[model samples]
Target: MFRRLEEGDPAVRTLWSQLVEISLQEMFGIFDRLGGVTLDYPKDGEAFYQPYLGEVIAEAKEQGVARQSDGALIIEVPGEETPLLLLKSNGTTTYATRDLAQVRYRAQTFHPAKILYCVANEQALHFRQYHAAARRLGFVPDSLELVHVKFGLMRGAEGKLSTRRGTSIFLQDVMDEAVRRAREVVEAKNPELSDREKTEIAEVVGIGALKYFDLSHDRRHDIVFDWDRMLSLKGDSAPYLQYSYVRAVQILAKVGTVNFPLDKWKGESGRFGVGLPEDVQRLVRELARFPLVLERAAADYTPHTIAQYLNDLAGQFSQFYECYPVLKAEGEDRAIRLAIVAGVANVLRRGLDLLGIKVLERM
Candidate 1:
C-alpha cells in the first residue's frame, strides 16, 4: 500500500482518504512507507513542544509542511488544507501516534513475526521514533520486530530530488528514460535489428542498467545519478549482462544441442576423468553462487549486492565464452561447457528479475 502511494496511484489515495479524522502523526501510520522529508522535534524541553502541541507538531511547524488543530489530531490526513496540518492541541496524539495505532493494529491482526519498512535513509530518525513508539505503546513489544530498511535518495543530474519546485523526478519517468536510452544504444550497435526487437531489448537492458546502478551502491550512501553510468553499453552495465546472455544463446543455437547429463555429470566418476576447460569450471562456480548472493541481498535489503553479483557472473561467463569453443568441442567436454553456459544464463536471468529488470532472450 505504501509503495502504491509512493507511486502516486489514485486508488491508494482514495483508500488513505477514507480513514477517520487523522492527525499529523497518523500520516506515517497510514503511509506504510517513509522517506525524503520528515518532521523535526525540539532540541531540549517540553515547552518547546508545548507551542506545537507535541514534538510532532513542532517538527511539522519547523518544516512548514502541516499542522492539525481539529478532528482526531485535527489534521485529517486525507483532506486538503492550506499549509497543511502541523500541530494540534491534543499534546499526545499526532501523525506519529496514528502511526503507532496502525502498527499496533497490524501487529495484532497479522501477527507478523517481523515487519520490514522500506524507507529512505533521510527518514532514519523518523522511522526509529515510529518503532520506539510502537514499543512504548506495547504494540508488538520485543517479540514482533520492526525494521526500517532504509535506502538513500534518488537524485537527478541536478542534485537532490526537489518537490517544491515541481522538479521531483517520478520513478516511472526514470524507468522510461532508461528504456529510451537503451533503445538508442541498441539501434546504434545493431542497425539490422528490427524496431520491435530493439524496443524489447532496450526495455530489458535499459531498465536493468538503471536498477543495477541503484543497487550496486551501498544503500546508506547517497548516489549521484549519471546517465552515462546508468545507461552505458560497455563496462559493468545491464547491456553487458544482456550481451552475455545473447552470446550464450547464440552459442547454444549454433551448437544445436541442449541434452546434457546434468545429474550424471555431477556424480559420475567420469566427472573427475575429463579435464573441463578451466574457464568453464570457473563460470560454473560463479553460477552456483547466485543463490547465496540473492539470499544475502534480500536479507540485507540491499539490491546492489545482487547487481554486483550479476555483473561478476556476466564477466565470468563472457570470459568463458571467449576462452572456450562450445560448438567446436565434442563428447563430455562439449556437454560440460554447454551446461556451464546454460547455468550462467539461468542465474543471470533470475538475478536480473530480482532487481525488477527484464531479461532479454536476445541482445
Candidate 2:
C-alpha cells in the first residue's frame, strides 16, 4: 500500500489522505475529551518528510557520518555496539531515515533551543544515535539540545499492556469508566446536585483523577493501573486534591470571603501576621514553597515533583484545618487563618492545572 502511494497511484493516494484526515479528526476528539490542548500547527506527518530520505542519506554520506554496513546504510554512535540503521539491506528506508529527516526539518524550521521527544524508554538508544547523527551531519548546531524524555509503561494485571497479549486497555474505555465511577461517587456525595452539575463535576474529577494517577508516579517507573486507588477521595490522588480544594473553598464561601488574593500573602511584597499558631505557620510555609516546587518541576520536566508537593501541601492543610478554626476565630487570628486556607486552595488549583488536572468548586 505504501509502495502504491509512493508510485503516485491515485486510488492509494486518495485512500491514504482520507485515512490521515480521519485519524487527525479522531485525535482531536480524544484530546478534547481529555480536556487537553489541540496544538495550533499544521500536520507534519511522515509523508511530508518521505521525499527527504534521499537528501538525508546523501548529506550524511557527504559528511562521512553515515556508512554502509553489509549493504545497509547506518550511522555509528560512539560506545554503542549497535549502529543506527537508516536503510535496510533491501534498499527500503527504516524509521531512522524518517525521524532524522523530521529532526532536521524541525531544527531548521522551528529553530527551537531544545526539541524534547516524550516517548517510551524503548527508544532511548535510538534517540542517542540520531541526536549524535544530527550533530555530526551539521543539521543542527551544538547549541541545539535534543532531549529524549523517556517514560515507563502503563502496566495492568497482565504486566505491560499490549495489544498482542490482549491486555491493552483503550484510552476511551478507561476515560468513560473513570467518568462513570466519578458520577457514582458524585451522586453518593451530593445527591442534591442537578444531573448537569453532577456530570460537569464528574468530567473534571474523572479526568483529573486519571491524569494524576499517572503523573504522580515517577516517569521512570511503571504504574499499576487501578481505578479504586485513583479516585479515592482520601488517598494520594487527584480527587483527594480536588476534594481538599473544595473543602477550602467551601470554608472561604461560608465565611463570606469571596476574594482571597494570594498576592496579599505571597512574593516579596507579601506580609504576615505575628504570633500565628504552629499549624498555621506550617501551612503558610508549605504554600510558600509552591514557587520552588514549580521551578524544579519545570526545569527537570518531572511532574511527579509538583504532584508530590501538592500531596504534602494537602496533608499539611488537613492537619491545620483539623486543629484550627477558620470560621470561628477572631480578629487577626481569623484573618490570617482564612488567608492560609485561601492560599492552600489557590496552590491546589494552580498545581493541579499545571498537571493538566482540574479542581472542582465542590466534590
Candidate 3:
C-alpha cells in the first residue's frame, strides 16, 4: 500500500505512504540476507521482500563488495567474509535485506535534502538500527538528513482495524457509509424532498463528515472511529460546517445581486475597505485569514489545521448572519455586508474542499 503511494500527486495521505515504501524496501533487503521466509505473511509470520531486489545485490557485487552463494546474496562487512546476507541460502529474499538495498540506492542516487521515513511510533528503534547499519557499511552520509515521521494508529469501536480478522474498515467503505447515513438523515429531516435532491445533499454532507472527522484530530493522536460523532449535525463535524454554509446561502438568497469582484479586489490595498458592524467585523477577520490558514496547513503538512480554520470561519459567519440583517440594512451597508458574507462563504467552502470535505448550500 505504501509503495503504491510513491507514484501519486502529493497530498496529506501520500506523505506517510512514501515513508512506508522506503522502510519496507530496506527490510526486504535484510530478509534476503537472512534465511528467507518459510512461513506465509500474516499467518505463519513468514515475510519476504519485494521482487526485483537482485538489482541491489548485483550492484554491490559490481562494486567489489558482495558475493552470491547458495542462492543467497552476501556483502562483505568491515572485518570478515561474514557477508550481510541479502537473500536466504534458500531462493527467497527477506524484508531487512531489501531495505538495505533501498538505503544503498537512495544514498547513491536520491541525495535529497532529507529522506524522511514516516513510520508508526513503535518502529523508532528499527529506524535507528537501520541507519546504524548504513553508517557502518560506509554507504551513508553523515550529513544526510534521515528523519522518521511517526504517528499513532486509528482504531474502531470493536478494536484496531484488523485485516487478519477481515475487520478492517476501508477508507472507501467509510466514505460510502457516511454518504448513506447522511442520505438517511436528510430524508428524515425533509420528507417532501425528492430522492435526487436528498442524494446530492447527502454527497456533500457525507464526504464532509468523513474528511472533517479524519482531520480534526492531530496526526500524532490515535483516532477512535465513532459513527455518531462523525455524522453529527452539531459539534466540530463536517455536517456542522456544511450547515453553516447552508445558512450563508439562505442569507444570500434573501439579498439579491451580490457581486464577488475578486479580480478588482486584487493588487489594490485599502481601496476596497468597507465599513462593517462589530458583528460583521468578526466575520471579515475570519475571511481575511483564509490565505494564511492555507499556507500554514501546507507548510506543516497538517490538513487538520485547515479543517479547524474552516470550522472557526463557519462559526463566525453563522454568528454574523444571525445578528446582522443584510437585506434590511439601509444604504451601502447592506451591499457591503452581503458582499462580505458571500466572500466569506466562498472562502470557507474552498478551505473545506481542500481538506476533502464538501459544502452544502442547504441543510
lDDT of 3 by residue, 16-131 (tens): 65666786666665444222234333321212223335665555667765677777766555544344665567555545566766666667877766676768777765566555
The C-alpha TM-scores of every prediction are 0.70, 0.93, 0.66
Off by over 4 Å in 2: 257-274
Report how far off residue 318 is in candidate 3 (Å). 1.3
Candidate 2 global CA lDDT score: 0.85
- Deviation (Å) of 356 in candidate 3: 1.8
Our model 2 lands, by Cα RMSD against the true structure, at: 2.5
So what's the TM-score on candidate 2? 0.93
Model number with the top TM-score: 2
lDDT of each: 0.65, 0.85, 0.68
For candidate 2, the 10 contiguous residues with the lowest summed lDDT are 265-274
Q: Give the top-scoring candidate (lDDT).
A: 2
lDDT of 1 by residue, 1-363 (tens): 654643447987677655522543455442222122344533322222223234444443455334444542322332223222222353334445445545665677778888887788887766666665456435585888788888888776778878997888766577778888888888888889988888877776776776678877889888888889777656577777777777777777776756534444343442421345555555655665677887898788888888888888887776777878777889866777887777777777777777666666577
